[model samples]
Target: MTANTGFLERTFKLSERKTDPKTEFLAGLTTFMTMSYILAVNPNMLAEAGMDRGGVFTGTILASIIAMLIMGFFANLPFALSAGMGLNAFFTYTVVLTMGHPWSYALTAVFLEGIIFIILSFFKVREKIFFAIPTSLKNAVSVGIGLFITLIGLTSSGLIVANDATFLSLGELTSRTSVVAIFSLILMAILTAKNVKGALLYGIIAGTVLALILGVTSLPQGTVFSLPPSISEVAFKLHWDNIFTLDMFSVMFTFLFVDLFDTVGTLTGVATKANLIEEDGNLPGVGRALLADAIGTVSGALLGTSTVTTFVESASGVAEGGRTGLTALSCAFFFFISLFLFPLFSIIPAQATSAALIMVGLFMITPITNIDLEDFTESVPAFLTMVTMPFAYSIAEGISVGMITYVVMKLCTGKHKEVSPIMYVLAIIFAIRYLRPILPF
Candidate 1:
């Protein structure tokens, strides 16, 4: 065997997936194409809360590289990690601006959250929680996240429009962008039906080209290569003053709650989609994934960015037949290379990624068949999970609702013996989240 091939086989067991280095590379590129928008969007958002745009930009990319590598090497899974979307908004707007906390204090809170996560992960508390979840709900989480991803893709591609009456309506298909996205979806469906290897990746590239040609999206104008911005302005700038104060307690708890549920939901959803969950519903190497996420969050705070978490966009790579960590490793390399080639990332229109995400979302739906519909106790909660994910616009929210409903159904049906202790704990936590707004404490 050749040296590179031998190394890949030994490290990632690429043979298990029947995927070669080239396929892994393409899958990685496909994942990056879909997620690279964060490289721009995160900085702009954080800047509104008093962060340096350039520093946040640099920190975002660097943290992604580190986290992705750790996930690749430690978890041996095809997941990618980066600064999360909603959490960053909370970090900037709610924590820093609204709460009147300094940006440094926000970073310190994130740092504390990360340390807490590390401790939890090391003791396998996070992994145990995964195991404690009922199999029916685990399957529901997977299907729920799938619907959530589809919602994101459709809205992002302008195939769906916001409305006052129904909350959502059909977009103008006559619009060039929506039309192009429709065509892209059909093309990807055809490729997948034809059993094309890396069909998702191929579709994304083709869709981007088609969008560019049809004037559905404008090409980015900038230098193709440039030096990365410096992170020194914000790096290692956390302030721990009053960290133990009551005010900081709420800030830290908020960070911990959101991060924990988000990570759990993402991991469970992605593992189910990729078929990485054990027959017993346990996710192998999950501790590593959790550790990678916690380390990423900590490093992001030190390097000057918001909390980092596993990207749901990694499902796009899995849909492209990426069954090993080589995909994540390859993606990490692209994140580093992107420091110079970032302008190219902008040229990939949202329609292309939306197409891929929508298709991957479709692939993740098969797990729903595993739910026992005859059992009302299982079916109702499962249905709640599937619908609430998209309607609520949050995977974690869907999971919370599902678990809460699951526990309620069990107790009401006198199936309390079926409910694990962790389920009760989660229900209480979800209760606290709901009560947060009204609690005078």
Candidate 2:
């Protein structure tokens, strides 16, 4: 083979390719379905926070397509990338609502944050952050996020989480929206259980079909959704008005830190679980993955959305037959195509995507096995992290509780000697993070 052909063969793994036409197509579809719900919900959530509707519309398409493409082309990990749950919620409620910052300022924050990440990534400074985390805590955080994402699905789907007094609300099951999502969940469960190829994809297709047949589609008909319109609207905010306020700066770092570490921790855990690391416990593409993530955030900001990063749902594809970069690329292709098919995305009921999320959530249990059950110190903190994230509806809270408990557990068990000095610094930092919003400065 010529050098060019040989290089392509190796990079794409063409020579050793195990082309499962049925499986690849399913993997592509599953990636698309994983994000279908977000296409609408993200915009809806942001729109409620005073974000431009056109910005919302354009940002989702561009960020989704750009993020997926970068993840496919550069990171070469089976995971798909996008603006994640915690960061988006943080952008909407925390920065905009609680902190009272404008969306334009938020985008400026995102752009600056991305630049910081890129600079840190190039020098490998981010590696120090990873080293600071104990393996035990890392596993716990991974499983905790799994719980966090699951809780999001449960609450959002109106599954009626139990309240303190009456104990249970049956959610909005009878509502047309909830009904479609529920049915999608059922369909996805059956297909996945039966080991059907692309079960998640099929479930999404079925759900989309059901939604369309029932007239659930919300995209205006006969309108072409292309690049320029989206470019005009997305993460495009530049607020000269609040450009130098203390509150604005405060929101910027908050968005930056939360988004930065959350992405790192989530990626580390998923990568570890997937055996994406080598025997030395090193991740070669980890820097590249982080770069892709940081760029995704910058792109989202440019397009007029909140912060963007890698979504853990890509783990679902990994759990399937997505053992190569090929899978990531396939996912990217579909995400870009969905731009033109925006109407289809808006129509697919949340329950259908819930099906994928629920199944993927279940798959997130791999990290539980990594917990050291024999060590109560490790076990207690790990369990608390997993439990609190979902129940409290806050990933930050879950992590806070975990950090405090881990520190206490280590000291009490006479294992404080085992903790790293850097871990001590982070423990102090996480404590401060927890206190910032509540305490009077």
Candidate 3:
């Protein structure tokens, strides 16, 4: 009836989702709460590579905002984008710290990978590669990523910790952080059980309130509002000299591999749940989504951060009934809000957000029941893909192994015709990835 309402509907197809702007806004807030941890965590990880912490912090936010807006308007998807967690860890711990490369060089590699991704997306090769993946493996990636997300939550919430004897043991139940996280989880479960709207959002706020009361983490001491950090230190600081060297090849390839699988896996997992997957098992506008990710990665490198990719955290929004780009647009607005409210946003301790991630993981696991494990041919590869993600601590590694095993099993079981040509190419790539450890330079 109103002009503004008509504009909103036309832009995001609100009627198709059967959702209003109010619900989409709430869903976006919920997604942002679950993923806001990256704002603090990504910069810290890059700082280990000798990056300017303040500069990285600004870069992270800028990259996320840019990518999410692209996803909202161009891709018209509900997914959110950010400097990815595992990819950043690998960029710091592996590329810069262990390999003796300067931080700028690593940043250059990320930029190159982004450029390559954009080229692939333009040619539609990225979409084809994703579509060639077997449906069983796609389902496995979803379940595997769900388990990986759960593992992250449990660790971040202090519910699980390293043990000298058993590798992982239960954290102290009496610890303030763990207690707050457990309470948040229970509260969310109850709310969800009661069919309450915005249960995840409510749970996160409650957890943060409890943390402030318990002092598991301290509140910010400075002024409530502060200016954005300067992006001068690292912006456009990429080291182009080493871009063509053989030593940079492995780093670039790893970045490319990890990002490719992570984006595909998130898109696959999220789109499948949203019923946006086509009858041919392809995601609509996936090329556009890949392009958004590529652009994010390039812009992140320019501004100073690691590879930016689609986040699995967006599933929280989808679970909350988000079905269009409006959710992503709303999330971008909150990210902008966070730029000035860092103190307030920073006070919401990791334990609070961990509860949201754990709950979303629980929501994602329901799809696993759709997978038929009765046939060993399908189950074996799927099982490897599902379990390897959490155990190996790499989504790309899980996808690689699952894809390799899927192709191998097909040939071994006399179902060679079932294998796609692209699958064979993936198998070789995975083989090369695994062999990198033993290869002599």
Candidate 4:
């Protein structure tokens, strides 16, 4: 295969290239519902950053479908890739809204970061980076993301409140949002436990209907779901001027490292769960998967969104026993169909998606058993990461605190010799990112 060969030839199919069409369709439906939440939100995030709202939305649909196809046909990773959730929030609310950085600058940062990802992946440095991460921390990160995602669902669904008077807030049991979320949560659990086909899809469907009854749709023809003309509007505007900022390196560095580990961690966690990895402890065709993911990030940025990566919802697909590339190909096709069904997504309110997000959050917790809490050295950092993520309302913050604690604890315990050299390097990088002041200029 040539260096520029498409995603397929890069990853080989070791098993038979056949699967049941019905099973694949069900898997595809499951993947689609899991990702439906992002269709509207990702575009909305990039638009706030001054990007073409239409282009980003179009990009969200295009890149997601394309990426999922690559994952399906090439990598067979049983995962869907798209503009990541936290990355969008970080780009919009944190970098743009909070830091007052120009949206263009943040995007420029994403572009540079994507290039870096591709370079690291092509050169095959991902394994070195992964080696630096302690297996204990890997377990912690997988579980932490689960906890953090749960919080996102709670806040998105309005089940939880933010009180200015009260320092902390919890679920408001009397709230209708709470009732819906709890109800959906129960439904999802029952379906999952019973091994129902497309249980998550059914759960999300129930949630959306619930949202309609609660007036969350806010659309005229509640049952008729179709894309509005504006859904295809190309919206990205290149701010080449923002590319010259001195802060580009700082911002890009953050994104590059964050995405690198995040992708690897997600792959490891999911691969472990699915038993898709070989006896060598490597997921078969993982290199190709990483390349596909890096390509997705690069393409996503060019399309006008954040760096794309494999979603955790791939866990749901895997849990459903989707072993072949057909499941992913089916998912890709449905995502493309969604471009014309924007009205459908637009009608499914955040609260309903929130129920599904909460389900994904629960689904992600399957890796908790991977951690060995018997050792205080490993347990402390892992515990800190798992607890801090939701409390801090940020995954990065949780990871940063975990890295510092992991390094500092190892050093103090005189077991610093046991820590990987890459971890030490990561500790410094994370330290610099943490110490840097958030300048609004």
Q: What is the C-alpha lDDT of each candidate?
A: 0.87, 0.70, 0.89, 0.72
Residue range 208-325, candidate 1, lDDT tens digits: 8888888866666766887888998889999978888988888888788778877888888878878888898898888899999999999999999999998988888887877788
Instruction: State every prediction's TM-score relative to the real structure.
Output: 0.95, 0.85, 0.96, 0.83
Stronger candidate by TM-score (1 vs 2): 1
Of the pair 1 and 3, which is ahead by lDDT? 3
* Candidate 4 segments exceeding 4 Å error: 1-24, 93-105, 165-167, 171-174, 218-237, 242-244, 277-282, 322-325, 435-441
Model 4 lDDT tens row, 1-441: 444333333342424433345666676777777667788778777777776676777787777777777787777767778888878888888778887888766766777787777788788777666546676776787678778777877887777778888854776765766666777777888998897877767777787787678765555455555553342334353356755665666667767767776677677656665666554445666776787788787777666678788786666666565666667777888788877777766666666556766777776677678777787888899889888878986666677788888999899989999787878887887777667687342
Ranking by lDDT: 3, 1, 4, 2
All candidates in order of TM-score, best leading: 3, 1, 2, 4
What TM-score does model 1 achieve against the real structure?
A: 0.95
For model 1, the local distance difference test gives: 0.87
| Model 2 lDDT tens row, 1-441 | 778656655775543545443454456567666765666777788886787666676676677677666765676666677766767787888877877777676678777788788888898767666655566677776777677667666666666556778765677677765676787778878877888777777777787777776665454566646443444644466666755778767777877777766776677656665666555445657777788888888888888887787776766675555655566677777767766766645666666676677777777767789779898998898898888877776665666677778887898889999776766777788887768799787
Worst 10 residues of 2 by lDDT: 14-23
What's the CA RMSD for each of the models? 1.8, 3.6, 1.6, 5.1
Greater lDDT among 1 and 2 belongs to: 1
lDDT of 3 by residue, 1-441 (tens): 799999999988999868889889998999898899899898888999999998898899999999999999998889999999888988999988899999999999999999999999999999999999888888888888789889989999999999999999999978999999999999999999998879999998999899989987777897879988998998999897857778899899989988999899888887777777777788878889999999999999999989999999998998888888889999989999988898889988888889888988888776677677997778899999989999998788888899999988989999989889999999988887689799884
Give the local distance difference test score of model 3. 0.89
Q: Local error of candidate 3 at 91, Å?
A: 2.4
TM-score of 3: 0.96
